[model samples]
Target chain A: MGVTVLQIFPDSSRSGCLETEKLHKRIMHLDAVQCGMFTVDCDTCYTVTQTGNNRKLHIVHNSETPTTTYAILDTGTKQITLSADYLFDLLLPRLDFMYQSKKNLKIESKGAKYEIGDFVVKIGTVTMSGHYKAILVEVEYLPCHTPALCWSLMREFMQSFMGSCVKPTLPSYLQNRLHDIHTPQDTVQQYVEKFNEIREGTTFAGTQTTGSGS
Target chain B: MAMPVNVPHVGENLEAAMKSQIVPDQEFLLQGSVLDTSLGVVIDRLRGLCDNADILPETFHDHEVVFVLKDFSAMSTPGPASQGVMLRVRRAMDYPDLPYQLRYVGYPELGNYPALLRNCLDIPVSNNVCEFLTELGAKLDHEFIAKGFIMKKGRIKVTVFKMYKMGIGMAKDNLEQMTMSHMVELSVLTTKTDMSVAEDLRALADQLKPLVQLERIDYRRLGP
Candidate 1:
C-alpha cells in the first residue's frame, strides 16, 4: 500500500516558520507524544540485486546509544531494518556491496508525533552533527495509498498550520517515483540529500593537507 | 451436510496436540481482503456473519511482529511474489499463557483460483524467540496491530479484522491505521482432498455479494 506523505520545509528567512512553542501547541490539538531519535549512519552501500531492483543498506554504529549496531535495508517499496551484527554474520558475507557513503551524518530530533483522526503529524527540528539546520513538519495520511487521490486533503491539512512552507503541488520525489510505493527510503533519501549538502559545504582539513596525487 | 450452528469447542488435548504438532496440514483455503471507502458495507456484512454463526463474544487481539529475511547467498527469484520471505510471530493480548506461534510463509504462488499452497507450521515458542530469528539473519519489518473477530460457519472460518500500522520508534499511541477498510477473510482448513471446498468458498463469497468482494489478490500484481 502507498502512504501519502507531505514534507514542509522552512522558508528562507525562517520568519514564516512555526515557532517551537507554536509547533507544540498545534500538534497538541491532535494529542501526540514525543518520539525522537538520534540516528547516525556509519556505513552505507547501494547495489542492484540479481532480481534487478536497486537496494541500499546502512550500518549504524553509535557508541553512546542504548540500541546496539543496526542496519537499514531499503528496496524501494519495503524497508527492512535489523541488527548490524546479524546482517554481517549471516547476509553481508555473500553479496557484493557497491557504492558506499563516506561522510557519516548524525541527525537528532525531538518531535511530537500524533495521529489526528486518520492522519499522523510530526513537527520537529532536524540537527545535523550538532548544528540545527531546519524545522521539518511531516503529515502522513494513512488510509489512501494513491497520492493523486489524497494529495489535496494532505495539502489542506498541512497548510492550515504550516502556511506556505509546504509546496502547493506534489513534491518532485513523490512525482518522479509516482508508481512506486512510498517506503521509509523516501524519508531516508531526504536526510541523505541534506547530509550531503552539509558535507559539501565544509572542506576537510586532513583531506586538504594530504593532497591526492591524481 | 448442514452447517453447524454451535461454536467449535476446544478440546482438553488442545494444548497437548499443539505441542506435538509438526506436519503442515494439507488444507485448501480461499481468502481475500475488503477495502471500501465506506466501511458500513463491510461492517454490515460482519454483523450478518455474527448473526448467522456461533461467534465468541471475545475478540482476538493480535500484536504481530513481522520479520523480512533476505538470503544474500542466493539470487532473489525474478518476480515480485518471490521477493523475500516473511517470518511472522503472533501473540494474543488476552491469553499470555497460551503458547505463541511463529509461522514462516514463503511467497504465495498463483494457481487455480490462485491457490496458495505454502507450508504453514505452528511452532510453540517463547515470547522472546523472535530475537533468535534476528540472530539467524532476519531483518525487522514494520509491525502492525490487528484485532480480529472470528466466526465459524460449518467448516468455514471467517475472520474480520482492523489493521493498524505501527509508527517509527515503537510508541504505542503512535499507531496509524493502514486504512478504514476492514479485511474480511473466509477460510476452511481440512486435511482431506476436497475440490468441493472451493465451491463452498465461492458460495460464501457470492452471499456477501456487492457488500464485499472476495477475490484472490496476487500480492505481486498490486501496483504502488
Candidate 2:
C-alpha cells in the first residue's frame, strides 16, 4: 500500500506567498507522497482510501477546526456511523421531521378493520441507541420524485430501484415535499398560513418571506 | 383451540403459554376465520396480574407502552413462530411488570398492520411456502414489482443492499434483520437507548430533580 497526500495551498496573504512557494516547491520534490511529518505550507490535506472506491477517511487543515465531516464507514459491516459533531447534530433534527411526517400521513378509508397506514405508524420501532421513546413513527408520502422514466426509456438500473419500491400513487403536493419540514401536516390548518406566505413567490426550502415567524 | 380470556372475573394475568404451544398451520392466526379469532379476548386476557397488591394508577392512567409483533406476514409458523419476536414480547410484557395492553398485527399488512399493531402481536393471513409454490408465477410477479428481487435458484438479489437486508431478511428471521445501522437510525429517531449509558452516571447527582411520588412498582426478580 502506498500513501498519497493531497494538500491545498492557502495564499490569503501575498507577503507569505514567497515563503509558501519555496515550501510548495520542496513538497513537490518528494515522490507523490513524501512521508515523515514535515510541515507544508498548505491549507488542507486529505487522506483517501485507494481501492475499488476511494473512500475519504479524513481531511486536516491549519484551522483549529475543519469541515466536510468524515463518515465512519465500516464497509465489511456496511454500517455508517457519524462521529463528527456536525453530522450527529443533524440526526436529531431529521428525526423530529420524520416524526412529523408520520403524523401527517395518517390516511383514513373504508370499512376495513384498519388503514394501511396503521402498519407504518405502529409506535415505530426504535433501536437501543437514540434517546427518544418513538422510532419509525410513520412513512410519509409527501410530493416525491424518485428516479422514474417512462417504461419505454427505463433502464435496468431504474427498473431495479422501482422494483424494490412500494410505488403507491402519492399526493402531487408530496413531490415538492420529499425534503421540507412543513411539507405535510395532519391537515391544511397547519400548512395554510405557510402556503399563503409563500404564495407571492411560491418559495420554500429556506427562503423566508415578508411574513416570517421566528 | 382458544386461549383463555382473563378479565375482572379472572382478576389476574393469564400469562400466555408460548411454551410448547405449537399452533398448527398458521393459516388464520389473525384473519377472521369461520372459527372466530377473538383478538379482543386476547387483549382482555393480558390485563394486570395480582401480586395481591397493585392496580392501575388513578391520576393519569393509560397504557404507557405498546406491544408489537415484529416481522409477521401470513401467520406465525403455527408454533414457536420466532423466538426473537417471542423473547421481546415476553421481556416487555414482564418488564417492571408494568401493566400494558397487548395487540398483534401481521407484518405485510403493515399497511393495516402498523396501525392495528398500535402495540401487540397479530396473526397473519398466511405464511407457508406451500400455499404460494403452486401460485409461483404470481409470487414472482408480486415480489418483482413490490420487492425488486428475482427468486432464481431461490436466492434474492437487489440493487440496494438496504432493501435486501430489510424486505427479505426481516420476513425470514428478524434477528438478522436488525443490523446496527438499523439501530442507530432508530436511536436517532425514537431515542430509545438507555439514557444512563450516554454519559457519566454520577454527574447527574448534582441536578435538582423532580419531587418523587412512587406510583406503581411491580418488580419481579425474573430468574434465580
Candidate 3:
C-alpha cells in the first residue's frame, strides 16, 4: 500500500536468533509499539522441458494480503508478475508435468512487526527447508506512496535501529520505481529478490561445509 | 433415484459443499457468422427478437489472445492425442480500467443435447497476464480484435462481433478486418446439475432462424 524497503541485516554472530534479538531490542528502544506478526513465503518451480532456456516461477504469499497470490515468472531475459486469487494455488498442481516444484527449496521469512509513528517495521528470520539462513528487515512508510518523495525520511528511520546497514540511496528495486506509486507487488518483488539471494547464499555455504568435512 | 437416509460422511459431503459454493461452469453455446453486407439486417433482426427491444444494444470493443500449453514430449505422438490445453485472455478495449479476463473452455460434451455443452471458467486477472502465460510455457497462438454489440434475453447472451487483425505494435486504430463476416454467438452458462438451460439456449438460437443460422459448432472439427 505504501513505499517499502527491504534490507538484509548482517548476521556476524553466525546465529540468526542473536541478530534478530539485537535488532528487536534496538527497535523497542525507539518506543515502537509491537504489532502482531507477519510472514512472506516463496515457492520455486522450475521448467522440466528439455528444450528452450530454463525458467523459474516464484509464487509468493504475504500474510498481510491473505487472499491474494503473487506469481513472478523469471524467464532468462525478463521477469513477469501475475497477481491472482488464492484459487491459483489449486491450478499449480495441474501444471506439474511441465513445471515441477522443488519442495526443499521453499523459503519463508517470519517475525514480529512493529509500528513507530507512521513507520511500520518487521524483522524477519529467513529460513529455508526449516533451517535458519539469514535476517531480513522491512520498513514501510505508511504516509507516502512514491519512494522519491519519502526515501529520505525512511532512510533516517531505518538508520535509527538498523544503523549502517541502511543505505543512503534506495534499493536497486526501488531506484527503478522511484517516481511511480508503490504497490503490494513491489513489496513482494523485493522479497523475491532477497529470497533468491538467501537461497544462493545457503548453497554457497553448503559447499564450504562439505569441502571442509571431506 | 432414492435419497439416502444415513448422514453422509465428511469426504462425501466435501464435494457437495464445494458444488454448492461455486457458480456454474458449464456453457451451452451456439455460433454462426453473417457476411458484412448483411450485418445491418442481422442486427435489426436481433434487436427485434431479444429482450428489451426498445433499449439500445450494449456495444463493446475487446481484444482476445489465445495461448496454448503443450508438452513437447507429446509432440511425437500422432492423431489427436495431444491437442494441448488452450487458455484465452480477453480485455475490453473500451473499458481500459477494467481487469483482464482469463478463460478456459473445455471440449464439447458428447450427447444428444439441444446445444453444445462444455466446461468454462472465466477469471479476472492482473494486467501482466500475457507475460505470465508465456512464463507458464503457453505459446501465443494468435490474437485479434473484436468489435461487437451484446444483447441479453433472460439467461442467454447474444453477441454479434466482427474480427479485426491486430496491426503491428497492436495499434488500436487503423485496423484491417480479418473477414467479411460478423460472428454471432448465443450462449448460456449453467451448472452441471442443470441441463435444462440447454433447451432455452436452443430456443434462442432458433429465434434468429434464417437471419443467422446459429448451431452447435465444434471448432476443432473445422481443422486448423
For lDDT, the strongest prediction is: 3
Could you tell which candidate, 1 or 3, scores higher by TM-score?
Answer: 3
**Which regions in candidate 2 have their CA more than 4 angstroms from the true location?**
A1-19, A29-69, A72-214, B1-224
Interface RMSD of each: 19.1, 26.0, 10.0
Q: For this target, which candidate reaches the highest DockQ against the unseen true structure?
A: 3
What's the number of clashes in each of the models? 0, 31, 0
Task: List runs of model 1 lying over 4 Å from the truth.
Answer: A1-214, B1-57, B73-84, B114-118, B168-174
State the lDDT of candidate 2 residue by residue for A105-210, as single tens digits. 2111001010121111111111112221111112222232231221112222112222212223222343344343431111221122222222232322222222
Tell the DockQ for candidate 3.
Answer: 0.16
Candidate 1: tens digits of C-alpha lDDT, residues A51-96: 4556656644422232333455555665454532211312332233
> What is the docking quality class of candidate 1?
incorrect
TM-score between candidate 2 and the true structure: 0.14
Going through the candidates in order, their DockQ values are 0.01, 0.01, 0.16
Which lDDT tens digits does candidate 1 get at residues B1-224?
22223322122123333355522343445555666564556655656654453443346777888886565555555643235566688888668887566665444445664344443434455455476556444578867788767776677777778888766675555557788667877766543244466577777778887777777655667888
Local error of candidate 3 at residue A94 (angstroms): 4.6
Better by DockQ, candidate 3 or 2: 3
Task: Kindly list the per-residue Cα lDDT of model 3 for residues B1-224, writing each as its tens digit.
Answer: 23223322222233464568444678999999999899888888889889999998999999999998766555656532256677899999999999888887888999988988887777677988997897677889999999999998889899999999986866677789888899999998887777888888888788787888888888779986
Docking class of 2: incorrect
